[model samples]
Target: MTSWRLSRNSVSELRPVLSYPFEAAPEHGELCEVAPGVYWLRMPLPLALDHINLYLLEDEDGWWIIDSGIALGPTEEIWEQIFANQLGDKPVKAVVATHWHPDHTGMAGWLCDRWQVPFYCTQGEYLTGLVYTRATSEHFGWTNEQHQIRAGRGQVGADAARKSMGGAGHITRSLPTSYRRLEEGTRLTINGQRWRVVVGSGHSPEHACLYGESLNVLISGDQVIPRITSNISVSGIEPEGNPLREWLQSHERFLQVLPDDVLVLPAHNLPFYGLHHRLRYLIEHHEDHLLALEEACSDIAQTAVELLPVLFKRELSDSQIGLALGECIAHLNYLYHRGQLERSVDDEGRYRYLAVDDTLPMRLRKRQHQADTELPVQV
Candidate 1:
């Protein structure tokens, strides 16, 4: 998913101030009550984002956990403390993964086995995670190298980039042998309150968000975050998927269905109130990026690598490059499918995008044609 970047200026212009009801996030291994019977748990992540927020709901007999932290020693230690100090004698009745990401589901298997609890998630996410964990180097590692090469990175660069891309699979532990599938609109009662499931895609396959009307809260997982735009990328596994379109459409549906005043408990950021404004901001942000990308492609065909600067204003680390590239391709593919741009693969196997509009000034058209011709043929 997308990384969090603080943009006070842009956010202020886009929407009104979002209320952060909590004065401070919970300390490690501790839980902060956000609503009645709902506790916020913050876990540390090794990544630049630094922390992931998980939720714990008090059930009649035990508790329900939403989004397991990554499978790491520190995370486990924190859980142990939570088990001993925070949860009292209550057991974890169920573990719900909002998506298949390691940060969200990495500890599912361990936690499930520890508590012997059922795993609840969508079928698509379960299967995807299963495949990802079982994937060999041939499937993930080699594929990444090839993808990098296709993006105009040479064989040497591809190999180096592959090393920086990290491990083959995201899951640190095996998933449960079986899972209870959570379909859209499914309803479950927890702690004497009814919560409905709302599913979305693009950031992850079948990402589940929980909306509790009685509690006036939404457990918005990665589907909606207060500070960061969730990463929506077309991965090598589904290169042709139009996730950007799915992401935008999901927000549209959320706007119609969700109430504006409900508190949003995101996977990463602090709990906030302003569901409608956040959805609109996410939609408009992507639309603006698409328009700018389309305009950039007007004069010449560009590969995803070539257009990175058009999308990101700052430099990216080696670890961030792969995700950036994937997101760039996703935006390009969205425009390509919508007839706003023409996509083509060069002899070297790299994909390039060109604007579709032909009504531009003759001088600009001639310059475009000349630029295209003068560009070196990769093959």
Candidate 2:
């Protein structure tokens, strides 16, 4: 029997409640009750950038914040509003991050230092978050991103990429503070409520998923969402990925253990019920992406960059295109690693891909049974 790898859930059982769309002038972030003691603190990431969700857990001693938002002007202003207005005297015991993403772990160090509280996360998450983010500072701050935009055709994306990078400097202004590592199945108590950790993969390495059994709440932390599928993008580093496979496996992990009625407190979308259904929908989304990829490449195998618009469509705006391209690379890398596609370099030093048999794509090969029913389209 084959051992199943970890993945992201792809079901659509729970849809976004449309709390606040991150528009040009987005709706400001606020604290909302997801479960009994679990609260989501929305943080602004301005103008087509990050819209992060920081969590707070009310406990007997004080509060335990999970995932501090980016440490920029807007994010800090909102954080001050939240910390001063709501959690004034409450002692922030610990801050837990789900992963190393800037949006999730951005202000962890600042918060921990401010409150004299210990930061908590997986060892992989804490260390990687610190090192990788710092190392990529130049890349994000528009220093070298021009190279990211397909070499010669890189003008249109340069500005946007620079803005994105500078935003990183704004968000990730704090690090070097200490953090405590939390492992999978780790249990803790908050204000009398008991919670366990459930880690997910593909989207980010060693991503943590918190489960509050008594309240039936899961602090999903980007592990799952309602409307839009969480991005499983492959970046400059770690070019090899089996994201489709990893995402599929992550969903099964959630389904096999998590109950249907558990309320999901996603890091992005509005919290809701139906974890099982959401898992299935997320799974189906990747499957569909793979199928779409298969169809797009049936005629001729294309490099991940060339095939992105075909998979996601060219209807998206400039920023959306970059994101779509990233996800495209992730899926394509996944397929490549699974041995379905062989990669080569042209004389011009450009990367190209070709399927094994040149007849049918791997996704289409065993897809007759499940592929019969149309899967939901990814936005």
Candidate 3:
């Protein structure tokens, strides 16, 4: 579930509106101290986005590693280097995976086995990872091919997506069979400081973000990023899921609970300080997209593939098409679930969406307006 657009142009306009607090990023395989006893590490990804950021927190006896990198030769090599050079004499006491995505938790089992420590993450994420890893097997019937076909992707597109998913190595060979579940409000004492877990969904099942009130740091695992919006897609498992709505609500919750000045350490981008600004930006960004999509479907019903050009103006590569399609369906499902649009299955087993009317109902319009003008919650 590497949810990212291959083309940066899709988010170019939003990028200039936000600012990065840190100019320097950690070199690959190296750690940069973002806060006292907390270090940031960047691992190389083989995709267009190119990198994922992992964090290490100094604990009482050892270190707590957050968001392990993908289980690839290069990524494992980087971890080896960090163990030899960066960790000094301290051993990794625990491996904390923010979610089930390979880029985030691919090395959880490997790290836990190496350190003989327990794996920490939400129960949903850990269980989903098991499902995804098993899905790579030949005997697994629910492949990405079927998922694409169910999402209105043509046969060619479905085949291409299947090939890409198989090649991505998303499901690590070694997945942890056991884990320690971290739920909302669960706090862990690391190095005399408390880090509380805050769970959010839409991007992944039970995505856990750690908030340290004393340090005013939020380890936002793919939940909130400064530049790019996290991928909120309608997967085959939950085809009718309105993840877009869940994603926005999660931001609202963040605004309610988090202080504005907390430095956010995201999974993909550089560390930044504008938590509320970024959250509001993401909310408005999707709202604008939903408006455009609603208008596009006013006359003719459209498939998720047909609406790609409406949402993403730029051309997409074969690999990006699947992700873009999933994202497009997410927005369509949001509108469909909200009564803004109507959905119907065609003769070919494809779902088409059409706007219900030219104008939204009073309640939906008011909701949209509130989202447009809503101010960030003051801490």
TM-score against truth, every candidate? 0.88, 0.80, 0.88
- Poorest stretch of ten by lDDT in candidate 1: 1-10
lDDT of 2 by residue, 221-256 (tens): 888976767888765455455665677788898898
List lDDT for all candidates, in order.
0.81, 0.68, 0.79
lDDT (tens digit, per residue) of candidate 1 on 1-379:
1112222223213443577888788899988888899999999988889899999999989999999998865999899999999888889999999998889988889999999999999998999888876675455566676677666666876766545433525536888898999999999899899999999999988999999879989999999998688888876677777999999999999999889999999998788887887787788678757765776787778888889987788998877887898898889889889888888879887877887755434433443444445433210
Model 3 Cα shift for residue 243 (angstroms): 1.4
> What is the per-residue lDDT of model 3 for residues 190-221, given as tens digits with 9 covering 90 to 100?
99899999998889879999998799899998
Please give the distance, in angstroms, between residue 127's alpha carbon in candidate 2 and its true position after superposition. 2.2
lDDT of 1 at 70: 89
Q: Report clash pairs, candidate 1.
A: 1-231, 2-230, 2-231
Error of 3 at 19 (Å): 4.5
Tell me the spans in candidate 2 whose CA falls farther than 4 Å from its real position.
Answer: 1-30, 136-167, 315-322, 357-379
